[model samples]
Target: MSVRQAQGPAGRGTRPGLWREGLAALRSGDLRLIWLAQVVSQLGDGVFTLGIVVLTVELTASGLALSGTLMAQLLPYALLGAPAGALADRWNRRLTMVASDIARGLVVALLPLLHLTGWLHAWMIPVVAFLLTTGGLFFDPAKNALVPTVTPAGALVRVNALLAGTRQVLFIAAPALGGVLAAAFGTMTLFWIDAASFFLSAAILARMRVSGRVPALTPGPPSPRPSATPLPQGGRGAGGEGSPVRGHLLRDVQEGLRYVWRVPVLRLMVIVGTFINFILSPLPVILPLLFLTVLGLGTAAFGTALSFIFAGFLLGVAFVGVSGSRIHLGYLTTAAMAVAGLAVLALGAGPPLTVIHLIGLAGGAAVGIMEVAETTVLQRESTDAVRGRVFALYESVSQGGRAVSVALAGALSDRVGLRAMVYAVGALTLACAVLLALSPPVRRLARG
Candidate 1:
């Protein structure tokens, strides 16, 4: 199907009514099921993250080992995200997501078993982390690609915002809850809960009816070979014959790349996302280290700071959910990016714990605005057929940027001091925002 046809009433050309139409789709049962599943799964993920980290620490005291475990969880996105995204486009998104949930559940279940049997070595953390993350590589892209299919185009911003808000809520509540659960019931119990959540998510998703409309690729003209079969009935081609399928997978990938490159707004958005992630990724990796080494804080203090960040994110998401669609998103994005940079700078400057928490909150809020706006822009601009591929590239850039940031942050903190590293990253992020503001495409988008 052509882009125009696929977009139908939901296309950009539609006026204010399109938004209402989108909202109607979101209110449907299928979409609600997906949203609910996402919430449950994300809550589980939040708890699992805290529980696993604490579990690893209990087994070993080395900071590097903990970092290594984190790295293992992240590496799958860097390595397999593109291919997994392609697979998501090829297969049933619902099935892909269901399978991912099942796989993750099994992985989490193994953690507790490993602990109970005294077989939980430091190396085991990375191995399990990698396996669980590999499932995420499939799950995320599938969920993203499935959204436009189930929800209305006009309602996308609101739906995205709502989902983002839920995720932020999970971030806020999960760590603290996980910490509490670990203290009261043990880390192994948290893993079991995490495993159960995934199964529950899968069960919910399995019942949703998602009749996704697959985009039909243009076929190539038929050849004159004697054995060449006539074009399938009603298949359109040049000269009224079935057009040969001109694009290979590699070619399709290239087409998606070109599409992003040619669209000035998309290009600018991708660049901003890449840079922001580069600056932000280091925060989580280094924050714990800074708390321990520089601030002389314990795990609980670090958790408190992290919670403050989540609090900021919740506030930001709420603000955006209320006002984002009405605002000129481009300007919001630029301003948020700059504010985030400043927040990070403040974080690194050795403020008191209270001040630090405030900075974290502010930074998280800025990130929330950026994420909601950026994702909405992408959804609005792209066609459904190529959306998966485009998002794949987006995910790849995000993952790669983050990985680089993590590695660089760890190195810089060790060599130049955490304060200098944080300030440098912050300044660089500020530069990126300035560059984004100056770009004509980004400026135009902001105005829109």
Candidate 2:
């Protein structure tokens, strides 16, 4: 049977529909292995983030230094995202992922080793973080591009939802566990654990039996002026000295960009997703202020409110995994945006803590739904040849938009009141939803 035909709606016996279907991807041995690797790596990531903060403070005690270190970890995604994706497309994805994990493991191991040698410095932390995150950038696109290969087309939503929801659960749980672990064993040990996690993840990935094959590109003549204008080059398998099957890396990046722009659904998704990211990025800053300044709540209340948001996200993921195939993605995404806008608008009212939690839950669910829809569509629409690059472009732009949004929102919030800023964001989201609803191409995505 075909892969799609092999997958049926999984929950036939006694398991809860949501749990059964959401975890259905685990039934596939290859996908289960990938998920297991993610669980290990992501948990380690949580601990690693905490360790970074603690280590940086111990080394520098400078808040600015801490911020810089954190930024270093994030900067690579925006800077190298596209090229990383292109590399994933060009190379064997499984090997690319394994290499990335091993590289990250080695880079992380350097931290504890450096400290043991009394050679570690505050500056070195950020440098190592930058390299570690660069490795993740390559790993992410490769893993994303690899998932569809291991999963049935009909099961893609369940797989994506499962992955996203697991990350969310880890996002909530890992830091608390990290804190306890750090207290029992020094922060240096956290690095060791994280390094070990990466290695374990690499081992898990290396065991997968998926094809190592990649798209074969046609070769062309080498550029005459190879000195001044260098082209991205692939290894020549059977052709002449200048003839590699794949184009130059630069040219491949260009093709990925052009492919995204030319594809109407992808174009709409990118533009809309980037804008939504911009709208949401400041929530980390804004939500805290909402609780403290506006609602006169404490840290405990803020944390609880955040929990509601996460819970909502989990619910949203479950909903999509179960029902997503039956719905039109374009419509679902647009409607989710509308709900998100209303939730944002409600937040501006500075309601009681309970009400705020409800709004947060709704808003979070909206975002969750939107994310799964967008990811599923991207995977469905893009061909395997360019899929990694497509995801990389989307991620890079989203990261850029998020960075810009955080900066701009902070500045704008000071000039205008926080509530006013919140109101404006809500209005813009609703407007964007309207734009999406009106786009014929977006509406026709699942239809076609």
Candidate 3:
């Protein structure tokens, strides 16, 4: 594979040049189809979440009931992420994704059918949520592992930016769309729409022409020692022997863990990523309290303020896609974390509404930068053979951190006061940024 030099510092190029580079990934037909499928499926997901929330509220008045639904959605990621990721490497990637979508689509459609038949029950809501996310556990690793194969190596960052941008846009748009549709029809209608979206996504993925195999690694960037060699097509056995079928699933999972621990860059990334997720997890719980109590704002203003975060995320992804390649990923990640810490600190200061909105934007942008940097580097660093398992371990720990942190944040805020909680989060984030900056391995992760 040939290498493309990183452009000079991001803003040195003309505006047109930046825009061209940002949009270049869309020129691949396979990526376009995948992007389209993602847009539809994510929209459906947003609707499904809203519908579940509405249904849960109607079922019970207790807040714990609502929290249980969230826990149900997160459980699969913690329990099955590593195994699912290993399976993605072992199986055909496209087929795994398609099967996941189809399975989820059918399961989702059952909600409305159950309602129509007078069999819908409150207990079923959390069950359905768990099952839906379980399918995603399999789908995500396959999709993430497949992207590098279909896209040109140089455009990988740009492609990741495009996909992340879509999520941000949908984050802002989906609620309003779901609300309007729900008011016009019922919440059950949202489920039907969500079901159809999954089917459509499956149909789109089915049309892609690639073989859906994790191809053997060609000579490119240096890989971490020992994991540098590619596994046979089906993966290796416990004794490093070739097997037409994958080795024991547990062994495959263990290999992924060992690879990350052996690779300095990946090990650091996973550590930092988990810490970052924990620090930021409070936003969802604290933001509402901050707006309603600290800022003396109404629900309408709170919603408006939330949009700034997603908008800032869009801006941040655009920046990375267009000009971020000029900076070493380690330096970029450290800078972004510093900015995020400052934004959180600003929030803790109890400024007026406009200032708070700006903080949200800055914080969101910082998160976007961190996300793209880590994902792109992870893809570049790991071999295709173990990529799925690596992603799975990272994802599993990240989700667990967020889940535990959110619960801890709520408890800590209750004890220390919300402002103090915010201050602590900001301080810890800055400390982590400093640590990243001081690490030699992290700073050395320069562009190829």
Candidate 4:
């Protein structure tokens, strides 16, 4: 358990240094495998999303079709996230991740063949996307909840930062690569590659050490050695006094909600978070509109701007990983939202495209800072009993927020100018930050 500690502001080392902690986790053998599995899976996801977009364009050339496909990709979090998370607590996390990966690989592997044989239809894209997303509903929370199990105490920040940073980098690179590969060979190639990534992810995750929380086990005859037996507690086998309440799926879902509702910080965080999620959208529509219609800039401009955001985000993660203890995470989150607001304003102000890219870069960094800060807080604070459900609720609500944004964007994008839409986004983001600063409950969060 001994590892290198990070230096605090007063010059004393307080927590584990990022690289040292990461290496420690890697040496343990579980965290590195989990990290690798996620990285590979995300690469596949990037290509898969790109391939789908290309296939959609090839099939129908309709905006409505594209929107539907996008929704299919996101909505499963809203629909099944709670149930899936509840199940994660009931099942073995490693097995859940492995099964989900294997299932997804099998499903995604067939998509390219369907297209090659002329069996793929435009309607089926959303259907397949929905199924894949369903797998994600199970996979994501399980993966998240596993971090505390695998990572050492006080090093959750480094572990979470690594996970978040990796995803952001992949998100930036994956789509572009997928697009190129799709154009060079075909969308089928992208699909096959993505399928392979999932299979590899599954193979790696299957070997991880943590068994995670399991279902309620009935007490049997007492052991002769009283100290050896584990009492059932909080849907897990913990050493405790009385038998814990055996939670059904519905009850588990309720317990997650109750925990959030009772915690002032989590309650307020989720509320403001829903609004942030609504406006701070990396919506599929935003980039295309910026590149093609609003800015009238080519893909090169779009690519540059996109890269700025991703790189800035990764940099921000590195910053947090190194200096998380020095900053107030709640304040960091508020400031990040404010920066996003300014980025929106810059986008709408008709500034030079280079200036716009710079602003986007800064905004991306702010978001990266916000993401790791908030997640570290949550991951550090939450107990294993409710961690999976907490993540599930957050995902569900965030996706719901995105749905609201999507609906607004669709309904208003044609009625109003894109500039007007950008302005509204900016204004709402600022308003959310203002509300966050004003809230007494959120302020108290930092003290605890």
Candidate 5:
């Protein structure tokens, strides 16, 4: 059932020729199917998001209507993500993922069918989006948790990097494809296409064999300081023989939070991740104002800038694949945040369009590198018992921060003026970076 390949330390097998390892994982066997399932599902996601926006707008003729659907997409992760993670840890990961995919596909299938039959309502757009994304809240953490178990330990960095890279690539491609399909054949057609993709993803995952349902962590001491300083792994839990988790869901949620609170590094990561999501999140709203009004650029120019930022992200990650293990993990993450702040500061300087694009690229690259570095560290340091919960908490809070930031920025931009708002964001980010740099505990943490 496992991929028939030599498993070695990620350093020896994945470090030297990381891309090769990722390709090897993808070019053959069970890993290939796992990777394909993710790719198929994500492409579907991109298309669905774009098509839905168009469809909702056509039905309601309001940008606010589109925003409602977007909020629906986000609400599940914000509200149910913790519970979803607890379930992932307690259940068979393979089945959790497969079931989620099937359910989401079915929900999405109803959109186009209902529309065709004149049963679709404008209100249903958000309702369906909420249901589909709720499936994602479960599916994402389960799939990520499965990777370290299935792949060589050393290759973890490469595999994680590839998974992230796949999603980002589609962020660019799938939307374009969706726009084309929706424009040519109508948004309902795009929904049908997305529904089909989800079914395909479920089918691929159903056959991919990965170890599932490790014994869950028995509840640690319910105190500010748990009995275990560094949470123990390698007992019956975490791929070993142990009692199944029958713990209260609330207790499981609290365990995940306490674990993060106790780890100095994890706390630092939370601080940094929250700021990163919050500060950078407003760029989409801010960019149009900057380019169209401030810079006197066409909409085409705004799109080009976005392309530049995403390209930089890809390139930064490409560098990470090569230098991942060799770099000091904590230091690289801290330094990347600091550098990103500098780039954002430059962005606020009202430079030429070319220079602005360059700044955006550098900022994005730094942020991208930080993303992989911290994820690898978390994967390495946390035990399998709490990994899903850890990732889910990370996803939830980061997303919640982004949502808050967009609203905050929209409120402030007109009051302070676009340029000043950009300056304020840059200043805050730079200050946060300085704060992290000054923390002795953060500085002393183990280097890469």
Candidate 6:
């Protein structure tokens, strides 16, 4: 029997209809493994981020130097993301993910070695950051592409909610623990912990079994494969030549870009996401200065502010989970982005800590809502064959926009003051949200 046939009714014996389908997908072993791996990786990533920043500051005490390190970490995604996406489409996603984990683990493990030898310098930090993120360039596309393949069609929203919720948890817990670890064992020890976490993640991933084997591209018809049950209506892997594909890497990159541009709703999403990133990019760079210099707070206080934002994020995630199928997602997305922008503006208005935390909470909630909605939209809209490449381009553009925004923020904040910069970014974000809401294509896609 065909794989689809053997599996019986597509979503049979599932809970009630759409909601049940989504829940079952979330509960699937494949998606569960992916979620588990991501949770582990994100937590480790938080620790690594804290450790790196603390270590860099200890070594160089220069804000410019730290900014440069962050820039280095982000630049690779901007530079290499398209090619990474194409490669992901052509490769076995499981292998791609595992290799990424292993690569990150090895790179992080070398940090202590460099530190012990006194070879770690402020300049070297950027290079290491680049290498680390380069691995992510490969990992992210593969992972995003894999999600739709494993889940039931109706379950995309719920799975996305679960993913968003886990990320919220990581945001809340990881940095706090990272701070404590950095204070106690030092930053180098945190790197060791990060490395171990990567290995653990890879081990977990090794056990997952993705349904469709990504076929090696050649000059002929795609290899025939064993069938699972026929997927549901609007099921994935339905179109295309299904042929062994071959093309120039650059051409593949161009093809991916063209594919994204051709889709009107996806294009709108890219634009909106770009604007949001532009608005938020300054927070990480300028917020520390604000807290330390303007608010007269210590590192611990700054961490507290971050925690407030994360707390809001957790609440938003929960909200998304509970209302995944019931809400008008597009409207929610528009509202969330607007609220996030406004909250950022409020954050800069010099309110008391209680007020600041409230603003942070609001902004975090907005971010959580926006992310889950956005991811679900993308998963539903894209074809599996092209999904990785498209997401790669998405990530690359988002990171590139963020880099530009960071640069702009730094320059603008330096000249006009941080408060003005915050207010300006907030205005731009709100404008983008309005634009997205007005776009007919975006509204239609959200309803779908």
Off by over 4 Å in 6: 1-23, 116-122, 215-243, 288-305, 348-355
lDDT of 2 by residue, 412-437 (tens): 88888788888888899999999999
Residue 266 miss distance in model 2 (angstroms): 0.6
lDDT of 6 by residue, 371-435 (tens): 98888766555666667887888888888988998788767788998777777878888888889
Q: Candidate 1: where are CA atoms >4 Å away?
A: 1-26, 113-122, 217-252, 285-306, 347-358
Cα deviation at 281, candidate 4, in Å, is 2.3
lDDT of 5 by residue, 171-266 (tens): 889999998888788888888888889899989988976656654554453122211234433222333433453667887788778777777766
Off by over 4 Å in 2: 1-24, 217-244
State, as a TM-score between 0 and 1, how close model 3 is to the true structure. Answer: 0.92
lDDT string for model 3 (101-169, tens) is: 999999999899999999998888889999998999889888887887787546677788888989878
- Using all chains and alpha carbons, the TM-scores for the candidates as numbered come to 0.81, 0.90, 0.92, 0.86, 0.90, 0.84
Q: What is candidate 5's local distance difference test score?
A: 0.76
Better of 4 and 6 by TM-score: 4
Clashing pairs in 5: 9-154, 10-154, 10-155, 236-241, 328-448, 329-448
Per-residue lDDT for 326-430 in model 1, tens only?
567777888888998898788777888888888888888998888888887776565544456667778888888898787877678889988787788789888
Higher lDDT: candidate 4 or 5?
A: 5
Q: By the TM-score metric, which is better: model 2 or model 6?
A: 2
lDDT of 6: 0.77
Model 4 Cα lDDT, one tens digit per residue, 356-392: 7788788788888888877866654555556677788
